[model samples]
Target chain A: MKLMVSVKRVVDYNVRIQVKPDGSGVVTDGVKMSMNPFDEIAMEEALRIKEAGNAEEIIAVTIGEQKAQEQLRTALAMGADRAIHVEVDEDIQPLTAARVLKALADKEQPGMVLLGKQAIDDDQGQTGQMLAALWDRPQATFASKVDLDGQKAKVTREVDAGLETIEVDLPAVVTTDLRLNEPRYVKLPDIMKAKKKPIDTTSLADLGVEAAPGLKVTNTAPPPERQGGKKVESVDELVSELKNRGLI
Target chain B: MAKVLLIADHDGENLNPTTPKAVACAADFSPEALDVAVFVSGDNGVADQAAKLDGVSRVLRIDNPANEHCLAAMLAPQIVKMAADYTHVLVAGSTFGKDLMARVAALLGVLQVSDIMKVESDYVFQRPIYAGNAITTVEAPSDQVLCGTVRAASYQAAGEGNSASVEDISVDAELPDHTRFVSVETHKSDRPDLQTAPRVVSGGRGVGSGENFDIIYKLADKINAGVGASRAAVDAGYVPNDMQVGQTGKIIAPELYIAVGISGAIQHWAGIKDAGTIVAINKDEEAPIFEVADLGLVADLFDAVPELEQKLG
Candidate 1:
């Protein structure tokens, strides 16, 4: 069986994102860009599945600018067998991205597709499920644990109330949550080896998909800042302050 | 006038409070434009609960056995079938809502406006991105049906005084047999729910080992508050991941939030930024949590929690 993992290049998790002063977009210039943390987890899970003999090949794919190949190279270093870069210049929304992935899936016919539940940049957790819907395949999202059987995969998902387990057949889509697995650090030797790995570049037209803006962002602004408050000398002072504010 | 259809979120017996809050969000539109729909497997009392929400014109109950487990594949097609009659389809931004709406939007060939914090008009809305660091206002094209999930914490639950008529609708959708429901392990607790609680007491790496969380729980019990843990604590196995409070975790906005030993990271602050009054207690005076805390105390949680519990008692 073959596994396809989707990786996204996003603003690093540590950086404090600033909205553009003109309210046009976020300030990405001069900011550190890294593979989305959750996608790294998904890639780790895919590597483990291969090591466990459940999968024969792991393909890492990304849909973004030329710089996104940096993330695909990182995935290749982390253990993906090959990389596919769907090169696009503009910002693609979730729906259109899913369409591009659907085209790839139709061509590759991988046994399984893995993706991060959401991207940290847009926080849109839609692509995986939308791809599943478009492909008319089963989807197990927010997966914390995955066990592959002969032709079935059991997924444990982190839900609102608690954990829910579900089973889906092969040729399904699985989205990773935070606790799936701690991604392995890319070793120096692995980084050197990744340079030789094949990365195929394709365009939206080649995938037979259109780059359309499904959701329009009319305005962008910073969130309202919370005002700072005073310090209390002691626990008694804290209690009195709570009482004074009628919060107790 | 535009008609809005709200998919109710609930378990077998009781309705999730977020459903009512989503209804409240729908109320932002015309007064008599909202319709609540409950889809359940058996004759669960959920339809009755959906009818009690204020401003609902009617409640549509769709009964089908496949609807029992809240499977997104089974629910999405049914919702898409019903969505053609309404201008907007709304649901809460819970896990169930996010999953179901994404599939529905895909089947309909549209985009889902997720976690909308404010509804500017029937077509325009505001949502947080970059983990709540920035707010983006978006508008759906008028030519297409608007589908989105409401941030339940941003709105109050719709009142229950009004009595709306319940209509039984028959739904027939070809649900795929590839997906099967297994068991669910829900953390059963008697404490107030973390999302809707009036007050929340959260601990961080300062709480130490998993067993040491008892101190935080003891204080929470005294104050009748829900217990929450920072991502560090959850990652350290001090608590379940569901108890984590941060940008990727549960977003909460309680009336009072007491932080114990939490060196506030920006991700954690994003979840609690909407909290009414924040109080931080950490031994380090320079911990970032103090910047937004209404009351800051530079004391060890071990000694401070016990003393504070006694004072509250």
Candidate 2:
């Protein structure tokens, strides 16, 4: 069985994002970029599943500009057997991205599809579920634990109430949450090997997928700043302050 | 006028408090009709509770044995079948909504507008991106059914007064067997829910171990506040993931937020940025949590928390 993982290029989690002054969008020029943290977790899980002898090949795919290949190469360095880069210069919303992944799923016919629960950039955690709906397959999202058996996978999802365990048949979609697995760092030898691995470049048209009409961003702005107050001297003073404000 | 269908979030027995918050957001647009769909396994009382929410025009009960687990795959097909009568579909941006709504939207051939914080108009809204660091205003085409998840932190729960009519509705959709419910492990707490609680007290890595969290809980019990933990604390196994408060965890907006021993990472700040009267108790004076704190106390949490709890009494 083959595992297909979807990785996305997003702003580094450590970087402080700033909205463009003109209210158009965020400033992404000259900023550090990295594979979405959750996607890294997904890739790590896929690699572990293969290492456990539950699966064989791992293919990492991304949809973005040419620079997105940097992320795909990072995935290759991490242990994906190969990579696919779908070149889309414009911003691809979740619906269009899911459509592209569905097309690839049809062509690759992987036994399982893996993705980050949500991209930290767009913050829209819709792609994986949308792909499952489009592909007419089961989806186990926000998965923290995955136990793969013959023709079946039991997934432990991190939900608001607590952990929920669900069983889905193979050829399904599983989205990774934060507690899934810690991603391994890329080694120098792996980086060199990844450069030699093939990356199949294609376009949305080549995949028979078109960008769907979607929500249009009208304005962008920074969140309202919170003001800091003076430090209190003691717990007594804090209690008194709370009392004075009717907060206690 | 826009016709809206709000999906109620519930366990098999009771309605989630966040469902009313979504109703509050959907009511903001003043839709011609605001109907709630309660998908449950049996004749659960959730639909009756949804009917009491102010501004709800009606409650549609979808009873099926397959809905016992609230699997998105099963609910999506049923929701799509009933979505033909409404112009917009909304749900609370809880884990349930985040897991379910996209599938419903995709089945309806539309893009979901996630985390709608402000409804600018029927078709326009504002949402946070980059983990609430930036807010973007977006517009959906009026031609298609608008699907969105209301950010629970951004709206209050609608009041319980009006009793809307309840209607039993059946959806003719094929439920898939590929997905099966196994079992769930939920932390049953008697304390106020973290999401809708008026006052919240959260601990961080500085809280030490799970046993050490007793002080945090004691302090919270004194104030009758809900308890939460930072991602670091949850990741360290000091608390359950459901109690996590951060960008990836539960976003909360309480009247008062007390952070004990929390250094306050950006992701954690995203959850509480909307909170009122923020207070931080960390020995690390340079902790980022103090920057946003309305009141800062540079002291050890172990000592300060106990003293504060005693004095509050």
Give the clashing residue pairs of candidate 1, or none. Answer: none
Once superposed on the true structure, which residue ranges of model 1 sit more than 4 Å away at CA? Answer: none
Candidate 1 CAPRI category: high
Instruction: Write down the C-alpha DockQ for each prediction.
Output: 0.84, 0.88
Q: Rate the local accuracy (lDDT) of all candidates.
A: 0.91, 0.94
Tens-place lDDT per residue, model 2, B174-292, is 98999999999998898998988999999999999999999999999999999999999998999988899999888999999999999989989999999989999999999999988
RMSD after CA superposition, every candidate: 1.0, 1.0
Q: Proportion of native contacts found in each model?
A: 0.83, 0.88
Query: For model 2, what is the error of residue A229's alpha carbon versus the real structure, in angstroms, after optimal superposition?
Result: 1.7
Candidate 2, residue A233: Cα displacement in angstroms equals 1.2
lDDT of 2 by residue, A1-248 (tens): 99999999999999999889999999999999999999999999999999999889999999999999999999999999999999999998899999999999999999999999999998999999999999999999999999998999999999888899999998999999998898999999999999999999999999999899978998999999888888999999999999999998
